[model samples]
Target: MGNSSSIQAADASGFTQSRSLSRSFFGAAALALVIILPGCATYSSGFAKVEQAAAVRDLDGAVKTLDELKLTGADEALHHLNKGTLLRLQGNYAESNKHFDIAKELADKLNAISVSEQLASVSVNDTMKAYEGLPSEQLMLYSFKALNYLQMSDVDAAAVEARQFDIKQSQIAKQNADAKYLSGAFVRYLNAMVYEAAGERDSARIELQKALDGYKKQNSGFPVPASLTADLARIKAGKPAPSEVVFILQNGLGPSLHEATVRIANPNPQNGSSLLSLAVPKLAKRSVPVARIELSAGSAVASAEVVEDVNDIAEKSLNDRLPGITARAVARMVVKNAAVGETKKRSNELGAFGLLANIAMDVGSAVSERADTRTWSLLPGVINMARLPLPAGKHDITATYYSESGAVLATRVFKDIEIKPGRKAFVSDYYLNPPAQAKAPQ
Candidate 1:
C-alpha cells in the first residue's frame, strides 16, 4: 500500500473571529499611507511568503502568516476560508468543515437575495457566476466540499461541483492551472471509485490511471493525500475492491514494526485468484487480519488465506527443514459445492485464521545479561488492539517505544483531542511505551 500523510484542516474561522475589525481599520490607514509613501511592499511580500510555505507543505507557517493579513470586513469571509485551507493541509477535517460552513454563511449574507436564489437552484451557469464574486479564501472551500462528497461515495454530485468551478474560471478568463487540474483529477478519481465499488475492475483501473496522470501533470507529482495513491494501486491490481477493504497506513506515523500481516489465496489454482497482502507494524505484538474475503463464479471458486504472524516463518532457518506453516491451516474459505453454503454464511469469521511462525533465533545460547527480541505482523489496516472502538469523546493517543526484550525506552502521546461519538463522553490519554529489555537470570 502507498503511504502518505493525512489532509490538514483548512478552516479559517478561528483567525477571522479573533482579528477582523482591528486589522480592517489598520489596513485602511496603511492604504492611505501607501499612496503618500513609496516603499511599502510588505503586503505583497507577506502573501508571497505564505503561498510559498503552503506549496512546500509548511502548513503551520502558512496559517500563521495568512492570519496576519488585514482584510476589510468585506473580505473577512475569504480570510476565514484561506485559514480553512491551511487546516485541511494539516489533516484537521472537522475544523476545516467549520470554516467552510462559516464562509458559506458569510457569502450568503453578502450576496443579493436574487443571487442567493440563483445559486440555490444548483444550475451550473448560475453557480459559476456566483463563484466569481467569492474571495480567494472560498476557492479551497469548494475544493474541500468536492473532496468530502467523493469520500461520501457521491461521485455525480462531486463531478457537478467540480464542473461548476471549471466553467466559472473559463467564463471569467481566469486560468488557475492547479484548480483546473484538481477539478479534472478529482472527478476522474470519483469515477474510478464508483467503478471499483460496482466490481468493474478494468474500468476502475483505467479511470484511476487517468486521475493519477492528471494530478501529476498539474502538481508535478502524486497528490499530497497519500490515501488516494493506495486506492489507485489497489484498483490497478484488481485486489479486494476499495470499498471492501481499507488501508490504514498514513504519513507521520512511525514505521509499523509489530503490526499484523494479511494474505489472500485462491482456492481454485487455475483461475488465478487475486492475492493481496499488507503489513501493519504499529498496532499489536503481531498483525491482525483486516479482511480475508473469498470470491468465486460458477464452477470457479477462490479463497483468501490471511496470516497474522509471518515473522515466525521468517525467523526459522531454512536449514531447520521443518514445514514452517501451511495456507489451509491459517485461512478461512467458501466452497461453491458446500452442501448448504456454510462458508458463505460465516464469511466474517476471523478466529480460524492462524499464524505461520518459525523460531528465528534461539535465546538458549545467548551470553548477555539482557536480551533484545523483535516480532512482526504481516497484515495492513489493522487497528491497534488497544485503541479499538474508542468511546465517544476526546482522547489523546500515545505511542511508546521499546527495546527488543521489552524495555520501555520512550513514549509519545499526541496532544490534539479527538472527539468520539457517544453521550457519556469517554476521554483518555493513550501511551506507547518502548519494549522492555529482558534480564538473564544469574
Candidate 2:
C-alpha cells in the first residue's frame, strides 16, 4: 500500500508507541514473554479433559473441567464461549447466557483495542494479546444468546438478540457487501421463529423471506426445508399454523486449529536475498459425516435434516480470513526482521552489553513465533433442525441420532413435554462419535 521506506517508518512508529505504554519496557517485555510463551498451550490439555468428559455424556465432569481452566488474557474469550455452549447443551440456560454475555462484552473490547496492540503483536505474538474472536464466533454469540432467551420463554429478550444480529450483519455489509454472509440462514430463520412466538406474524414473515433469500445466497448446497416453505405459505395466507416442537441439533465436533509454516522472500533484494518464514495457525477440518435425527411421537415420525452445517460456516469464515492473516503475518515478519537487523548493528558497535541484548532478542523471537490457535472449540460440526406439529397437550417424544450411513447411534426420550396452543415448544440435543485422539476447545 506504500513505499518500503514509509512502511519501515510506520513500523518504527509502532515500536515507539509500544515503548511509550510502559515505564520499565525491558522488564515488562521480559515478564510478558515468560508468561505468554508457556501459557499459550495451557488451555489445550484442560480442554482435552473437558472433551473426554463430554464424550461420555458426563455433564457434571465437563462443567468441572471447564471451571478449572486458567482463563487469563487471550484465553478469556475462548473460555467463556466454550463454557457457555457447554452449559447450553447441559440444559443450564440461565447460566449459559451469563457466560455468553461476558463473552460478547470481551469480544467487543478486544476488537476495539488500540493500534499499538497490533504493533506489539509483531514481536510478542498475537496470543500474548486478547482474543478478538472470529466473525462466525461473534455472530454465534447472538444466535445462542437468543436461543437461551427463547428457552426461558423470554421472547422480548430473544427479539433484542435478533436485532443485534441484524446490526452486525449491517456492519459487515458496510465493510464488504460482496463477502459471504455475516450471519447464516439458520440465524435468520431462528429470528423469524422468535418473532412469531411474540405474536408478530408480519415481522416473522419478513424475517422468513430474508431467511429464504439469504440461504439462496449462501449456496451451501443445502435445500430449503419443505416445512419452512409450508410455514411461509401459511403465514402469507394469514392462516394460523399449528404450534410445533422444534429441535435445534448440534451434531459432531467442529474443526480444530493447528499450525503451519509460510515463507516470504526478502523484501529488499539489494541486502542479499533471504527466505523468511513464520509459523501460522490454521483451522483443520476433522472429517465428520453430516448428521440426521428422527423424531417420533407414538407411531408418527418426522426426520430432522441439516439446515445449517456450522462446520461449513466455520470453514468459510476461516477461508475468508486467510488473505488478511497472510498479509498481517508478512508485515509482522518484516518488522521483526528489521528489529533483528537494528539490534545486530548496535551489538557490533557496543561490544559485550549490546551482544547480550542481541542474544536476548533472538531468544524472544524464537519463543514468540507460534501462531494464535485459540477458538471456541466445543462447537458442533453441524446444526440439524426439525419442526413437528403437535396438538396442545403433554406428549412423549423420542429423538434418535443417526450416522451418515443411516445407522442408529443413540436415542433419547422426553416424557410429558407440554405444548400450548398457538405457542412454540423448543427442544435441543447434542450427539457425536467419540474422538480417536484428545482435542481441546472442546
Candidate 3:
C-alpha cells in the first residue's frame, strides 16, 4: 500500500484542481477511517504496562497503569475486572469487592441488547461490542468476591457469594448440557468450609457432598483430593474438628489470549459479500512454576491439592464458544467486503477519490479484523487447597512452593498464625512461576 498522506495529498490536489467540494468531504472522511482506525490498538495490547507492573508484584503500580490506559466505553468491564484483581491482591478486600461489584453490574448490562455494538461486532470486529466475560470468568469473579468477603471476616457475605456461584454454575451447566463442565467443585468446597467455620454443620454437610460429587465429575488434569472424601465422611458422621487451617493457593497466572488470523474465501458467496480473512482469539497458556503448595505448621504438614485448572477451563470455555466467535468474525469479513464494494460504487462519483476510498476501506478492514482478546488475565491458572486440622494455638507457618520436578521454587513464612478453637483459619496466596513473564505479550 502507498503512503496514506501522500495518496491523500495527491487526491486533494486533483479535487482542488476540479473544485469539487462534495468529493473532497467524502474522500476526507473515508480516508480518515482507513488511516486512523487501522492504528487502533487491540484490548490485549493495551495491557502491556499493566502486565509489566503486575509481573513485578506491584499491585498498586499495575492498577495505576491500567487506569492510565484511558480505555473506551467498551473496555469498562475489563478495566474494573483488572482493577478489582489488583486491589484483591493488595489485600484490600473492600476496595476489590467494590470494583468487582461494578464489573458484575457492567457485565449484566452488556448482556442486554445493544443494536449498535451488535452491528459493529458483525461489521467491524468483536471488540466493537462491550466485553462480556466468559462463564468460567464470571464464576471466578464470584469466587473472588466470596474470598474477599471471607478475608474481611464476613461469613454471611461469603456464603451468599458462594451460593450465587453455585446457582450460576448450575445454570451454565444446564445450558451446555452436552459439554464438559468446570463443575465448580472449588466454590462448593469453599461454601462448605464457610459453613463449617460458622458452625453450621448441616449446611456444611450438604455443600460438602456437592463438592465431593463435583470433584469426582470434574477432570481438571488433577486427582480429586483424598481430603474431600474424608471430609464428607467426617461431616456425615458428625465428627467436628477442634480447629483447622485452610490454605487456598492460587497457582500461576491464568491463560491470556492472542489473535489467530486466516485468509479464506467467503463461505457464503450468495450473500453478495466477498471477504478474505478472519481473526479470532486463542488461549495463550502460561507455564505453571509450582505444581502445588505445601504448608507446614509445627508438626502438621499438608500439601494443597489442585482442584480447579483455570487453563483447562479457559480452553474449554473458548472451545465451547469458538464456533460463534468465528461465525461473527466471518460475518465481519463479509460486511467489510460489502462496505468496500459499496464504497467503490458511491465514491466513484468523485472520480479519482473512488480508488482512494476503495484502498482505505480495504486496508482499514484488514487492520481492524482483530479478535476480541479481552479477558480476566490476572486470574490464577490453577486453584489448590489444603485443610489441615491443627490444635488451637499460635505457630510458625511455613509455605513452600515446589516445581513439577521436586525442586523448590519459593517459600513464605507467617509467624504466629493463630488457630482458634472450633474456628477455621484461612490462608491465601498467589504464585506466578516467573512473575516477570506472567503476561508476556505475544
The candidate scoring highest on TM-score is: 3
Per lDDT, the best of the predicted structures is: 3
lDDT of 2 by residue, 283-387 (tens): 776655436688988776888877776677777777877777777767766676666566455444444544454555555544556666777888887788877
Q: For model 1, state the Cα shift of residue 166 in Å.
A: 6.3
The sequence of per-residue lDDT tens digits that candidate 1 reaches over residues 1-442 is 1232222222355456345544543443343243223212222224545555654557788788787864444345555566665665566655766776676677656555465444322211111122212222233345465544544445566555555545543432244433333334544554555555445668667767766665565452223235447667765565664112111111111112222345554354222212322222222222221222222222322222211112222222111211211121122111111211222222213222200000000010010011001111111111111212243444444444333455544444444334323211111111221112211112
- Best-first order by lDDT: 3, 2, 1
Q: Tens digit of lDDT per residue, candidate 3, span 351-431?
A: 566556555655666677888888987888888887778889887788998888888878888777788888777777777
For model 3, give the 10-residue run with minimal summed lDDT.
Answer: 266-275
Native-to-model Cα distance after best TM-score fit, residue 239 in candidate 1, in Å: 7.7
Worst lDDT 10-window in candidate 1: 354-363
Mind sharing the TM-score for model 2?
0.84
The alpha-carbon deviation from the true structure for residue 293 of candidate 1, after best TM-score superposition, in angstroms, is 28
TM per prediction: 0.29, 0.84, 0.88
Model 3 root mean square deviation, Cα atoms: 6.3
